[model samples]
Target: MIEFRRNIVAGTAVLVVAAVSGCAPGTGDRAQPATTATGTSMVTSPTAVPGTLVYLDVAAGRPITMTTVTDGAARRTTFGTATRSDEHVLVPSPDATRLAAVESPDPDSVAPGDLVVISAGGARHTVATKVMWGGGSAPVWMPDGQHVIAAVGGQWRVIDVANGAATPYPAGPRPGADGGYLTWSTNGHWRAIGGSTDVTVTAADGTGEVKRSVASLPECREAAGCPTSVQAVSDDGRYVALGHMNSDPSRVTEAHLVLDMRTGGLVNLPPTAPGGSVDRVFFRPDGGMVVRTVTNDGRYTFVLLRADGSTLATLPDTTQQHPSGRNLVTYRP
Candidate 1:
């Protein structure tokens, strides 16, 4: 039993608010733990991804623990009793009932290893520990929460959580000639295959493929180098966040764009907030943008942007995000 920092937190917003497990925080970052409120007003579309909980191992130890700030307090749960710390990647199942971590015993090497699946209740299991290696790749959960997917050795495989069995997964996209990443839309209907030169979006079931080059996207190409790649897709699969980084820091600041996947339209986004550079971006179920910014000094902030690329709220003293996508969670030591 380990103690984690508070998940449920209150904070200063641009009128932003934070919460945990359906409970809202008080008025500031130091808000004390409060009794949980019952009921959730969260409405979901038929295609909405059901997020169970925001979880991962914040630290490694004998009894591996995953935590989240819930109800204005830290909530730590033991999910890894005997799991090895060398397993560098920690991914939570979409349903939050289990976790997937690389079971690599050698921390220094990026060699293949078995992948372990540990239930939130502390049940540990695996399929191919020595077959997959870490190349900055992570296990991703499908929106349905029934399967876990990973790209191994440039090939893709899907694991059925129920039986710990795996089979080849036909992820649509030729391997990038110059290294790339595979990301899923929030609803799991769209897969974004991004590389240095181009990006392709296609249906998860392998249909409706659209490919665009870095030079073709607006504000990229000759103007600001090239659109690096799409960082995140909106939950509704209507918008995507694209980024372009400047090679020469003195000449260009990082540039970002919100591309409408439905209409091929592009909207520029603000690259910086109070904290620092925007480090991460995700779309809320309602098509709002959840932007996490990190300053040069290492502090973090969560800013919410409307669908039209306007700031909805700037949450202060927030770090970790709730998996529910509605609020940001603050962690206090």
Candidate 2:
């Protein structure tokens, strides 16, 4: 249920993106021109933000698509068609060329399933395992990109994607001081663990010592059983993001919380106007952040943020109807 990121020494506050009513300057509410192209379009003119935005349409069983932005133009490339669903939690490899998916055949039950590894050319290799759900439970691709670390039936195992081989991984999913699973930085140098009350950021070295612990927002602390997950970690390890993932239309919970690891400051991110919650957060290699927000009606918007958590631009609506934008899973910068 908790969400996922990595480490830094000396902490400050956090950063998150939200759609505020009375949007003020530096509130990070600035919206960019939307990208409306849909279907199997090979290329688009450009997106407001420059980077590769990947979307997996699990409902359609379409190939995984990657939209790369350079200068201004945006071009898309697709991997081979593979069986994916909302029941699957997809995590890209460290090199961004492959993906590790936790696939559950039954959508209603959180049971164990096959760990599908999709190669750059779209070939899939399935490794049977009990890895269920996303966040910390999603398979973690090690720095080598060949082996993945996943928690299997309470014990952690290092899985080999090439063949269905696995070995014990004692240094398993490192939990934060508050017991939440740790999310690591892009470089694997930093790891962050967040909970309902506080978030702890630490270096990834053998020390495993708590370097900085910052308080969560008042809203998070007030809500009972307020779920928290270390979603994204800035590559520089200075900022960490905590978010909630509520797809149900009835529940409009707190959107997100961002902590500045250097200063321990928190960005004020309220929920969207129409029962929208921050579903996911991805940090660009340049320190920028991409936030995925979902509304009560099942609409999704991808927003780009500066290093300081200020709004930079927004992508097109990634609803289920759009073939190209459907199931906006994650982004790679």
lDDT of all predictions, in order shown? 0.49, 0.53
Kindly list the per-residue Cα lDDT of model 2 for residues 290-315, writing each as its tens digit.
Answer: 67676777666667665444566767
Off by over 4 Å in 1: 1-57, 69-74, 81-87, 152-154, 174-180, 215-231, 236-238, 242-266, 271-275, 317-333
**Highest lDDT: which candidate?**
2
Off by over 4 Å in 2: 1-47, 60-86, 103-107, 120-122, 132-136, 164-182, 194-198, 206-208, 211-224, 245-255, 262-264, 268-281, 284-325
Worst lDDT window (10 residues) for model 2?
Answer: 1-10
lDDT comparing candidate 2 with the true structure: 0.53
Per-candidate TM equals 0.64, 0.62
lDDT score for residue 127 of model 2 = 78
Instruction: Give the distance in Å from residue 54's predicted Cα in candidate 1 to where it truly belongs.
Output: 2.4
lDDT of 1 at 120: 64
User: What is residue 195's positional error in candidate 2, in angstroms?
Assistant: 4.7
Give the worst 10-residue stretch by lDDT in candidate 1: 1-10
Cα distance off (Å), candidate 1, residue 306:
2.1
